[model samples]
Target: MAKLLARAGVASRREVERMIAEGRVALDGVVLDTPATILQSLNGVTVDGEPVAAPAAARLFLYHKPPGLLVTERDPGGRKTIYDQLPDDLPRLVPVGRLDLNTEGLLLMTTDGELKRQLELPATGVERAYRARAYGPITQEQLEELIHGVEIEGIRYGSINANLERRTGANVWIEMILTEGKNREVRRVLEYLGLKVSRLIRTRYGPFLLGDLAVGEIGEVKQHDVVSFRKDPTRKGGGEAPKLVEKPRPQQRGMQQIPSAPKAPIPKPQPARRITKTSANRADKAAFAEPTRQAQPGRDPVVLTKATKVKRFYDAKPKAGTGAGTEPVAPRAIAPGQRPKVFSPELGRNVRAKPGRTATPTEAAERKPAKATPRTAGKARAAPSKPARVKIHKSRTRK
Candidate 1:
């Protein structure tokens, strides 16, 4: 069946069905007439007249893929592929994910299709690091903003830890780390910020690094390291971090029993002490008590007020040219321990400037009366109490 072929790594289930329909699948030297035929074992199963091989052991390899090589197994244009650069005697391996033809660096490969699918999934929370050379004018502040994430062409990218490494005129270098491996995500995000990426190289993937690995070189991950890596979880609260693992070697001891240490018992939490109403009231009074002022010999004692009273800081220096009096304000006292129900003066703007105008407290407090102008001097005066019109008319008639 198609499931058997897929499990054997011949092709996907759907692809196996397609091959069966095309008469490419056979059993016992006879071409399969239909996909409905079932087989429990892959002993006599074949595809395209080729025998189906047994599933290979789970193996992982780290490859330093070159820039021009395609990550896929085949290219319609007959271009060079990642497999072409791999060393001989290596098993048939599948890439974890596809890297662009021009983008190069750490690329993971595995012999098991299931492992490839697990690592390739975005939910794995595997981080990919890249160093990009771009051309534009940018600052550290601008690159730091990528932490909050950015939206490009209606596609939103996850949080990126981007840092500006160096700059040479319009050309600059930046380092970026992101969890989502969206297609052309890095290039698109930089381009959105008015930067054109010239070259991009992935330096790290998860805990694996491409340190000093020459282009087209491949290396196998140690068995113990792979086990440790596979133990890591992709979701929050899934499991703990990977433990330190030693290199694999022949076992010296066999069938020996070792006991683990006994764990200590956890202590139970104690109940909190409850504060009485009278104690709470005392604490409140202590917090709100104001400073006391000693009474003068002949003057009444100043009763200090609670925290609810107004407190003002008056500047004592007078204006140089105007000679306005800058007397310090007298301290006003309220009854001791008196907590006013209304709001304090600080919260109340006593003299508010008109909207669209700004006025300081000192200017509002030191304002003076306006003086009359020359034009309004005569009009501002009162008229004569009695009119002398009758007397003036009689004198004129006599003249």
Candidate 2:
């Protein structure tokens, strides 16, 4: 019954249990007095004579509780409570846990009572931290002993980690962390050590920090952060844990740290040789030098390489009247002191013969001057020279 009312957003599970014990809860017109009554739904249930509304989306707030403000809705002594300090437009909210009037710092408030119950349960193992300004002659060893928690008035505290900061004139700042938040835990613990606590500020609750939030001010945790905290609220600050960032690996202690990427080896520098203008000119001349050759005839009269193959290639082509058809005739290679043959048009053939052979008179006689064909026999007559310039003599007989 209590859980159902809480799930319905009537109040936190613990608060609902308290209300049931007070006979303020009823089911189907019957006043209920026990939280153990199990019910399927809140179809006709009433809490404090009012219908319970359906559950709402989870919302959370981080409030910086200032000293002297009670963390309650009402105080019998007419003292100021946390609700009076909140904005009027704020939604109905319940503190996740109590921060006594004298204690100040981070106090988580939420609209989802179930979430409040989840976070406040000691089984969740959420850590809470407080920095106490105490006047005492405390030592590090004395504080470390609190790891094995101490008991006062027959009530035992769970393990706590306490550390002492610097001291000035018997006034010291001490930091203590504990998973459970028993009432007046920090003050009583310090007082047991003969130290008078001047102030008690809870600097951390679960995973949330007090940070720079001013006194009596409130801020909200983002929805995603609240969801993450509800998923695993067992961390320090009772909320999302601080992101664990990897620290860059530093130089190894004993052995030097190895470089991730190999360093490029630098090339050795060479001594530059100094070259004079005279030496430079000599080198340029040598690089461009040509071996002198004896001059050959039928070759360029100037400085040029002889192109013997080019002339041979063209000469190898068959003459137009060659009887060999289109077959290219291999040119007879003319050596030094040798001459190429000529074509004999009168003979109607090329008369190239053996090298060093002299032609006989009969053969020479065989070569005759070519006779013109009819097409070529008739010569075109030049324009007849203008009729010889004739100046008629004037025959004026004694005129």
Candidate 3:
């Protein structure tokens, strides 16, 4: 009975059993007591007081779920759900796997609960790819180490092919590909590595991608493609996956059949040609062979070196009062009590006179300024002497 309900797109087998336990599934106005009570057909069977519709052909849809929406049908907290964002004419679809409220990316929706279960099972080894922008210091070597997998908080995550995409100031973008998508696995693994994940986007899942799928938009997979994918989930590299479709006309929503254009013939890939040492030597000789042309009389002969090519520019003429080998100008005479300023070789100009000090033409410029004091602005005040003690008072106290 559970299998029948699951195949009928009512729910998964386990969910059907749970519904029976809750007395929500009834037949002939009598609630079912157990899922074990099997019937050949769903004659008068009803789920939640509604007659179950006949199982139509299995359908698959790629929905670009935006962040901040629950994947469930309804939320007890009255938060928005994925259903609220979907079109009104979409069928009773179920998400293959749950995406967190803050995780935005590709979500597979299917009418057949059995198909959903099959796709969600980890044993299927369908690869899921995600791009995460995290804030922290992470190196390419550290990300590469994730290929061995990491364990955090007693939960052992499977091998992940993680690569450092690029760095943005204090944040880094990481691309990770994994098969086992345990609950919060990506977040947990990244945080354990001392990274704070700011944003995570699932770019690819199995053979499908979230390509060009606008948020809140959905595109259905053709029936033939769905059947082929179910037969072999690991298939790859034959053709491009379906893209996210725009909203159809209200009248043509579910019944419209998109005509596929003829596909161009793909040329068979040629095998790589193996080269022997002799062939490699021949190729090298051919590449390095000198041109047969004789050098022109007035032109410099072209020289080719194994090192990088460098273009030598003509040496620029020295500007006025600059460059080496130039004679130094004599210092001008200084008037009495006035310091003569010295020209700084490093500064390429006359150095400024030191504060409260004089400089000679040959004197080196002061490297630092003297510390300022209260006396710098005015004359220093003399310390006040203590008052003279009275000897008569002391004598009277002694008497």
TM-score to native of every candidate shown? 0.52, 0.55, 0.58
Tens digits of per-residue lDDT for model 1 on 255-345?
5555887998998998987999999999899889996777786688667887874555664445564445656555566576654344436
With candidate 3 superimposed using the best TM-score fit, by how many Å does residue 88's alpha carbon deviate from the native?
A: 0.8
List per-prediction Cα lDDT, in the order shown: 0.77, 0.80, 0.84
- What is the RMSD, in Å, between candidate 3 and the native fold over all Cα? 27.6
Model 1, position 313: C-alpha lDDT score:
62
The best candidate by lDDT is 3
lDDT of 1: 0.77
Q: Kindly state the number of residue pairs that clash in model 2.
A: 9
Q: What's the TM for model 1? A: 0.52
C-alpha RMSD of candidate 2:
30.3
Q: Which stretches of candidate 2 lie over 4 Å from their true place?
A: 12-35, 46-51, 236-399
TM-score winner between 1 and 2, please give it.
Answer: 2
The positional error of residue 259 in candidate 2, measured at the CA in angstroms, is 66
Worst-scoring 10-residue span by lDDT in model 2 = 240-249
Candidate 3 — which residues are off by over 4 angstroms? 12-15, 22-31, 38-44, 48-51, 237-399
